[model samples]
Target chain A: MESKEINLPLTDKAIDGLQIGDRVEYSGILYTARDAAHKRLITLADAGNELPVALQGQVIYYVGPTPPRPGRVIGSAGPTTAMRLDPYTPRMLELGVKGIIGKGGRGPVVREAIQKHHAIYCIAVGGTGALLNRHIKNVEVVAFEDLGTEAIRRLEVDHFPAIVVNDAYGGDLLEAGKAEYRTKAPPSP
Target chain B: MREIEAGVITEAVAKLAVEATHFLPEDVEGAIRGARETEQSPLGVQIIDEILENAEIAREQMLPLCQDTGTAVVHLELGQDVHITGGFIMDAVNAGIEKGYGDGYLRKSIVAHPFGERKNTGTNTPGVIHTEIVPGDKIHIGFMPKGGGCENMSRYQNFLPGAGREAVIKFVCETVDQSGGNPCPPLVIGVGVGGTAEKAMTMAKHSLFRKIGQRSEDPEVSILEKTLLDAVNALGVGPQAVGGSTTALDVFVETYPTHITALPVAVNIQCHSARTKHTVL
Candidate 1:
């Protein structure tokens, strides 16, 4: 499959053009947040405080990477399940986040939010961290360091791999893919 | 009588913890390799290729296969004839986890409390350890570093005695269907039928140790495994649930004697990165 390479801080054109199941390689910057960091961000948002990182036109990767070894920039950094962050996703979109990257299917609310807010949901292959870290050139803790792995991080990247799971136009690759292959596909022989 | 030192167990645990993370078990690797030949969807095939490449990278770099690195779950079979010369076994096991997680640079995922502070333990101590006393003088350890993704999708059911094989089959298929892309397929579906609730769950987890296509010794149990494997694949959840074939590489069914009124079942879903390694001392 030919993968489209996308530069981050995604523009409306890029988000609008993406379709469910289109393979894409992302470059530039991606902010990292998992459960704890998300909760803190929402708390900050509710209190009318500034977020640690600017969400406008930026991507958030749902990951809690392992500590890097002696010389590495980042350790095994794979996507965690995205559904866990569904509750905060709409609010995140409302705050101007344009793209979300993680693994697995998003809930209905998130799918709706992605369409309404004109954001994209992409997925890197889960459990492929050793390969994934190769694309992440640099990473630094940006917020909530006490949360350890759950702390937010700013990641500089080059050609990070992902596939659009839910595109901005209300297309869902997960559901469509399943429906397409359910009948025509044969069991593994 | 054979004597074993507590420190030795700890050292072994520490070593295996890092090893299991770095190296993908051969059976799992082989099954994934096999998926490429069978996964019909072009995307699914690509994902399989990526997974295989990831395992290679992890081994070569001595890095964890996944960031979750997981909660260290140990199934220890201690010999009845052996005497431990040092400290308590559980304490030693925990010490091993702390050292391994710290030294290996694996993530400490376990929290201090579920409902309270929910603070990270800093050290991945308090690993889930289940010990069984057996007849031999050797201690056998089965270590599985279970990631949160698949563990969350795992299911347990208490079926009425009248609910036969068909109902059980429905439950397994439905479980995988609902799991979708969350557990990271193509999965290793471990089905434990009969026995009580806990026993079913334990058996389901332990059954994952078997190599793909390895059948149960009993003919009837073996048939159920085959049936479930086919049924799970038929659901079309595909690799990573993006769709195609090959939803599950294998469905392993382990059964025990159950009460006259109950038929308990557990489905322990293991992802493509099934990090399990065992040793006998």
Candidate 2:
């Protein structure tokens, strides 16, 4: 499959153009956050306070990396489960978040929000952290260093690979992909 | 009685934590490679290849295989005649985990309280260590850095004895279907049956150490393993849940006799990053 090269600060046009199952190489910035960091961000946003990480027109990568060993930039960085971030996604989209990177299927609320807010969802293979970290060239802990791995960080990545699983126009690659193969699959033994 | 210093166990456990995090077991690595050939979806095959590549990169660089790094689950087979000197068994094991996580650059994932403050313990410890007295003078320890993704997908139930084999078949298949890509398929499915609730869960987790194609010693249990394996693969959840021909590399079932009226089952999933290491002392 030919991977479409996607530039960062995803344009509205670029977001609309993606379809489920399309492979893409992302070159730009991804803000890191998981359960704890997400909680603090949303809690701040709810109080109508200034947010730490820039959200508008940016992609948020759901990940928590290990401590870097010696000279490495970051250690074993890979996506955490995206579904855990579902509750905050609508507001994140409302705050002009353009894309999300994570693993596994999302619940309906987030899927609907992705379509409503004109955003996209993509997945990198989970547990492929060792390989994935190679793409992340730099990291700065922008928020919540006290949370350690769960801290929010600004990351500069180069040619990072992922597959589009959900897009603005309502396509889901995971479900469609499973259905296609299930038909040909032998009945349960 | 033979005596071994508890400090030795601590050092050994530390090495195990690092080794388990960095290397994918050979059988697990081999199974994923084999899954690539049988995987039907182009996406599934590509994902499987990435996993294999990740395994090599982690081993060479001494990187923790996954960011989750995992809650270290250690199984100790302690010999009846062996005496552990110097300190407590679990305390030493926990110290080893602290040293491993600190020294190896692995993440500390354990929370202090499940319900309450939920503060990270800062060391991946009190690694769910299980010790059982056994029949020899040597000690055996098995370590698995059990990641959260697949562990979250695990399920347990107490079935009515009348539910029987068909019920189990249904439960096992449904679990995989619901798990989808969350457990990071292609998976190694571990099933524990015919025990009490806790025993069933422990056995399910323990069975994951079995290599692919290794069956239970019991003939009847072996057949059930094959049957469950076929049914799970037929679900087409595929590698990384992108849909393909190979959802599971193997289905390992471990059984124990239980009460006449109760039939308990636990399904534990091992993701493609299937990591574990063991040592005998």
Candidate 3:
């Protein structure tokens, strides 16, 4: 169970080194986006217009965090379901996006893109937002403020924990991990 | 008739929203701790540890347990003999939600329209409020902040009367299997059986408010709960679907008398967060 300490704007070497089920402590910048912001990003990309933030060699976290209370940098910030972003993921990867952070299994197209683009997909513990928020050091809205929480935010995170669920080599931990632990179905009642 | 002020209802619901978001109910917390100890996979154990740690941090700092904060669902048990004063009950509940979501810094997740513009309401108003008239004079309010991930995984089916207990067992297990890690296992599954389609769905959602590990009073229903729980845990979906022996914390079933020809069933899946709070006024 070797754990890797990686930074954002991930290097090609770093993405290549990741494997399904590998533990990772990610630090550095992470841009947050969920359904609404993702739609806007895809629209912008389709129109051949510039994106609000550069995508090259960067990681995007599929999250829409709670509003920060007074004196706090951010609120409970955790990953949303990832499958909803599948349509936009391949395009982002084509733009040199290095990694994605979200929960649950990704679609086939996104998985194919991960292998093709040599990108990685990681998952923070879903529903563990309070703990995850402690790892974030700074946050600022970068685009789509009209979407409110769904607005894209540039974040600086330190020791933000996650496990690789999809690797650049066409491995998927969600399938492999469950297969390894699956037991015989109980007899019919 | 006893009179209760609208502001009182608003204050109560407001507090409930914040507390339910920040605190994992005692039963749910206990189940997670128990799951951590018994979980066979190292990865599962690690995930459970993080979940418990998150709960601790949320409780200590008064921060929300998850980023979703969820769509506020308020269930009200209004006594027949009691009178609501000052304003419309629905408005007061909505006002409470606005205050709670605003004051607690919870996310305003409600959208104005399902289709078309898809604009956010900005205020987490018009909470999904369910009301029932009861015998007692005191009103009971149960507040549950339900996240979208798990709700998305819920399902309903109208099984033929011949479908039997085996069919149910299979359906529940398969649902969890298909959901994999998306519903955020280890989960609390609520099953509703023996009612009209809508009634069954409502029962399934309401059953989730029951304490974890509490069984239905009916002998046959309790057995079904146990059997479903065991079968689901056997799926090895584990914590976050990474793999483990503790996929489900518990299975709760609520049943009603049904027409002889119909056997409607519904499954409402709840994530490990399993947040709920109640107050009687």
Best by DockQ: 3
Give the per-residue lDDT of model 3 (tens digit) for A1-189: 657999878998998888988999999999998888888888898899998899999999999999898999999998899988898899888877889999999989999999999999999999999999999999999999888899999999999999999999999898887777778753443
Error of 2 at B105 (Å): 0.3
CA displacement after TM-score superposition, residue B48 of candidate 2 (Å): 0.9
DockQ score of each predicted structure, in the order shown? 0.57, 0.62, 0.65
Supply the DockQ value of model 1: 0.57
| Model 1 segments more than 4 A misplaced | A184-189
Q: Each model's TM-score?
A: 0.98, 0.98, 0.98
What is the lDDT, from 0 to 100, of the residue A89 in candidate 2? Answer: 88
Off by over 4 Å in 3: A185-189
Q: Write the per-residue lDDT of candidate 2 for residues A1-189, one digit (tens) a residue.
A: 889999898999998789998999999998988888888988999899999987999999999899999999999998888887888888889988999999998989999999998999999999999999889999999999998889989999999999999999988888887888884444352
Candidate that beats the other on DockQ, 1 or 3, i.e. the better one: 3
Which residue pairs of candidate 1 clash? Answer: none
Model 2 TM: 0.98
Give the per-residue lDDT of model 3 (tens digit) for B46-162: 999999999999999988999887888889999998999999999999999999999999999988898979788888877999999999789999999999999999889888898
**Residue A45 shift from truth in candidate 1, angstroms:** 1.1
lDDT of candidate 2 at residue B140, scale 0 to 100: 96
Task: Report lDDT (Cα) of residue B250, candidate 3.
Answer: 95
